[model samples]
Target chain A: MRVELDVPKCVASGQCVMAAPDVFDQRDDDGVAILLEERPGEELLDDVREAVAVCPAAAIRLVEG
Target chain B: MSDALACPVTGASGPLPEYPLPRAAECPLAPAPAAQELRSEKPITRVRIWNGSTPWLVTRHADQRALLPDPRVSDDDLDPGFPYVNAHRAAIAPVSPRLITNTDAPEHTRLRRTVNGPFVVKRIEKMREPVQKIVDDLIDEMLAGPNPVDLLTAFALPVPSLVIAQLLGVPYEDHDFFQRSSSLVLDGSVPADEARRVSGELAAYLDNLIIQKTADPDDDVLSEMAGRVQAGEMTHTEAVHMGVAMLIAGHETTATMISLGTLALLQHPDQLALLRETDDPKVVANAVDEVLRYLSIVQTGVRRVAKDDIEIGDVVIRKGDGIIFDLHAANWDPEVFPGAQRLDIARPARIHQAFGYGPHQCLGQNLARLELQVVYGTLYRRVPTLRLAAAIEDLEFDHTGTTYGVHGLPVAW
Candidate 1:
């Protein structure tokens, strides 16, 4: 599945990273989300979903293949 | 014939004047007086409000969490023309852009979207190294000094303050300005005029920073915001307001938690010992939640307003009525947290109200958690022999303000 983030909506709170580290990582300086891959492995679905749910700004979304 | 006597709700009762209503000054967390009483009764009784009516105090965990995000209630304090003036005048004055704390959905969602990128967990994890380095440097400075040091001034305050400053692309040299302004703004007793002056100065400084970032784009979030402004995605004023909010909220809450969390852990030696031995991140994570619940540094969630007449429990709240979710009282409620008062680092399945609930929950929670996890992990490991320098009774807790914290925490290793 592909994950798309509305970067403008993200606040860099790190909920996505804490929930799904493999798929999402932050930039070194300002701590903004830097997705590692557009489509992550199937096994990481639970975590990615949690990220979507917990994001205070509701910035993350899943694009199922 | 003797007339039947009835208890009048508005007038005095018998010879002993009716139970005097509880003024903000009489409230334990009041700023005017240091000797306010803490009403910790069972079943969560209603307290007579100074505003001439009584609002039910939902002291139990289940009740508060259940009602916090209820559609019937609201978070807007301005609908009734700011009733909290008697309570929070000094804390929020010379208001900038409407803050996340005061806004609800739609509007809140829109405002939060402007700068949500910096706080995502993935982004924050990338900050682990830098944050750890910041913590390490602060600790090094603390150890460089004498044995007994004020952890509040040295380690706890600086780490978060510097991290937040860096995140906003504000120079670390301006840490004093940010720290002082935040302190004054958060202090409920500060005069409104002084608070406004400080806020104006901070806003002007932030405005300058935003302009510089606009002129010369860089990798920092501020530069990104500047870029967005140029592209019409956001305005320069919006960026300034958000930046100021993030800087103030980011550092103030985390700094208070670190100091108070440490004090909590130190007081409970068994919990501290257990935390020291645990290497598992999950275990450490659970411990962080417990500390948040136990200390509840942010005493109450921001006020919410009732959009329409609503009934919470047995009480009927009229439209536009203001409600505050008492996080501290909720966290300590026995119905939700069995043995709620005890500080158990290993407490499992603990859901805390420290970050509020539903859509308006704290946007910076994850970053706050990451800071706490790193700070607590390194703190106990590096300063294994750490202990309080002053007696527990002597410690002065600043519960009078919105952010509850000890005035100073002196420690020795």
Candidate 2:
């Protein structure tokens, strides 16, 4: 699974990064959301979707492989 | 006309107009001349205004603070002839039982205690790292862009919305709806019919979410409230009202403060540069307080009705009369803050009515402080090159609304 983020929409509320830090990271400067992993192993799919589901701005998405 | 009625701003006053007075464009802070006039005399004074009848205006720093949590000051608008309630009736309908602002004493204390644990100083301190991460991520995007980003929409609105949404356990996808509904509710331009329609829809949405949480609880605030409601600690209706109130108050006020604070920083380049150079958290915390005090975006406080005959300063407020504590005026009073008009981050012993005083002081103040400390600290350090896209004078402040804010802060690095 690939994690995608609409950077503009990401408010950096840190929900995504909190839920799945391995897949999502916050930029140190402005608190925008950034995806750390383009594609993750099948085992992490649940975590990625959880991150998307938890995003307050709906800025995160999971692109399933 | 007595010389005592001199205006606070111009130091010229006679018998001033009444409560719920029409908006004065030049001085939006105090609606009545007596309010401004009272400010000049003492740290706090009272003004009697006759909107249709008579109402008392609390104009001093200490007095406003004293009255906020006073039992004699009721928050109930159900009273038949209260001026402020009747005046704004077209604007706000009592959708839910009055939340924290309107309630008093034991009930207010009880309701406030339920979620107080989450917002305590220590718990909020624990959120610093997470809040910092959020701030850093947002700044990263602003830098990624070319130039001239609309900070209000891109930065200010989303930051608080995301933070509060996470706290409430609401999904991010739902924020767009939350933001829209909240804006509509706050926006005075939205006609009564449309505002009510939007509010009803939003309430329905929240009701559904409450039902979902009731069935399958999680480790979120909403879930916690659901459990409390089920256990008879809180009513189902209280849970629903609280959920909506938390969502709106938690986000809107902070968002406006952030945006307005940014505008202040940009206008004062020296202060902006000072923030850029400082890495100390103490300095940043002080800066946050100063910004909150200076901007006071919550503007006028939630209205409180006089439960009994109460004397505030020199004014005797009769029973059933409504009073609006002018937060902006109190925060800006020169008595408490020597250089109250200036935004000095280093001002010592700074106490302002920004978060309010007494028992009803903002429950979310700790959360707001943490979010601000992170945002201001990170923004300056990362974007030292940041500057406004437009001149400060050219920017429009949201003067007409109950909440004061800049419509949009166009900026670039």
Candidate 3:
């Protein structure tokens, strides 16, 4: 599985970081999401999915194969 | 349809249950009974609001999630169909400056960007140590000062005021002034003139503070906004208003959560025990979200005007129609949260809409959550004997304010 973040659409609510800190982080300057792991391990999948689900701007996408 | 279901004002087919329906006295913690019923029976239905305008009240969690982010939905308060929370909001809409709260993208996206940097989860996490200090000091003061104190004034109210003041670089010495003025501004029952007066005072105060920060900037949110104003990224007034917005937005709502959240814990001894006994930060954090889900404190539903015709489920919301997304209703929706009425701290409840959803969701939510986590984690453990000094029935609840909270939480530890 892979993760994507549309930084333009990110509202900086930080729901993604709260859901999956290992998979996501926010920029210190403007809080736009930063994808830490483009392709996370299986153990982190559920948390990544939650990050995708809860991002207020709907900026995070989990591309599944 | 039966004549009984016909709305008198709109001649609509179903009864337009009034918007901002009163909560049942017996279940002070829950959303209005009628609103929950509407979630199940008529997820998207019209309801009359303060100005006699009939706006569609979207009650279901699924429906709110689907509709709030749609481009057809608008945050513009200037639209004729926009459902103002009350008369004061209606009166002030025309003169209000464009801010992150009232604009849509790309304007909202721009305005929000100028301020979002400091509030991100990482930025807020840095404050946990300081926030813990604030909580500890306040608890110490409470312990030293009096027994059975009014927790609302003693601890709950000061926590956010002090924190926000330090963050905004506003002098905590003026907290009493800002707190009082901000309270008047949020009170729905306050007359339009009085609300305007207090809001103006707050704006002017911040405007002056911004000018000072511009000269000798401090390490704070207001300073960052002031830098933006200098860089031509935003207007001077915009920076000032943003400060007021942060104070008004972050202050009372967080204070309410502290007070009402404590009240909720005291009411549910089992849940209180879990919170008190837990040494895990994750447990404390999850408990904070669960309590947020349980309370869903913001009573005035997120309001918007439909910019274009949009079809969802069976109803078609026409262009120029108004919509209200009842966060409490959606948070309590049984489809998403089974046994929605129960206040269980162990639930996986981060999905709640208490901070709302979409781009206009609460900007200070991460910070608010951090404050809550600190207080919920520390207070119970520090004062294991904490109990309500007053009967739940005897407590007064503020129904007219933007956020629902108790007037005074008398607590004895």
- Tell me how each candidate scores on DockQ against the true complex: 0.24, 0.01, 0.83
After superposing candidate 1, which stretches have Cα over 4 Å from the reference? Answer: A1-65, B1-46, B81-97, B172-199
Cα lDDT of model 3 by residue, B1-413, tens digit:
11111211111224878778877676778788788778888889999987888999998998999888787899999999999999989899999888787899888987787788889787788888988888899899999998989998888878887788778877768867866777678656689999999889888888998888899998888888889899998889778777777877898899899999998888788889988998999999899999898889989999999999999999999999999999998997878888777788898888899999999999999889999999999998999999899988899999887889988899897
Q: In model 3 chain B, which range of ten residues has the least summed lDDT? A: B1-10
- Candidate with best DockQ: 3
| Residue lDDT tens for model 1, B207-277 | 89889988887667788888888989788888888777787777768988898888878867888898998
lDDT of 1 by residue, A1-65 (tens): 88999775555556677778888987543455778878888899888987776554557899867
Q: Measured by TM-score, how close is model 2 to the native structure? A: 0.74
Which ranking of candidates, highest lDDT first?
Answer: 3, 1, 2
In order, the Cα lDDT scores of the candidates are 0.67, 0.66, 0.85
**Chain B TM-score, one value per candidate, order as shown:** 0.82, 0.83, 0.91
Candidate 3 local Cα displacement, residue B254, angstroms: 0.6
Say which docking band candidate 2 falls in.
Answer: incorrect
* Model 2 chain B: lowest-lDDT 10 consecutive positions: B1-10
B1-413 per-residue lDDT for model 2 (tens digits) = 11112223543344544443333444332333444455666433333443455455566776775676466767666564344533455246455365556566566555555655456444456778867776777778777875888887777877876676667677768977876776776556689999889988877877777779989887567777778888888787787777777767777678887887887777667777878789898788789988887776654445666878887556677888767676666766777777665677888423566766545667677688889988998877787777789976567777545567777888887
Preferred candidate (TM-score higher): 1 or 3: 3
Model 1, global lDDT: 0.67
- What would the TM-scores of all predictions be? 0.76, 0.74, 0.92
Better candidate by lDDT, 2 or 3: 3
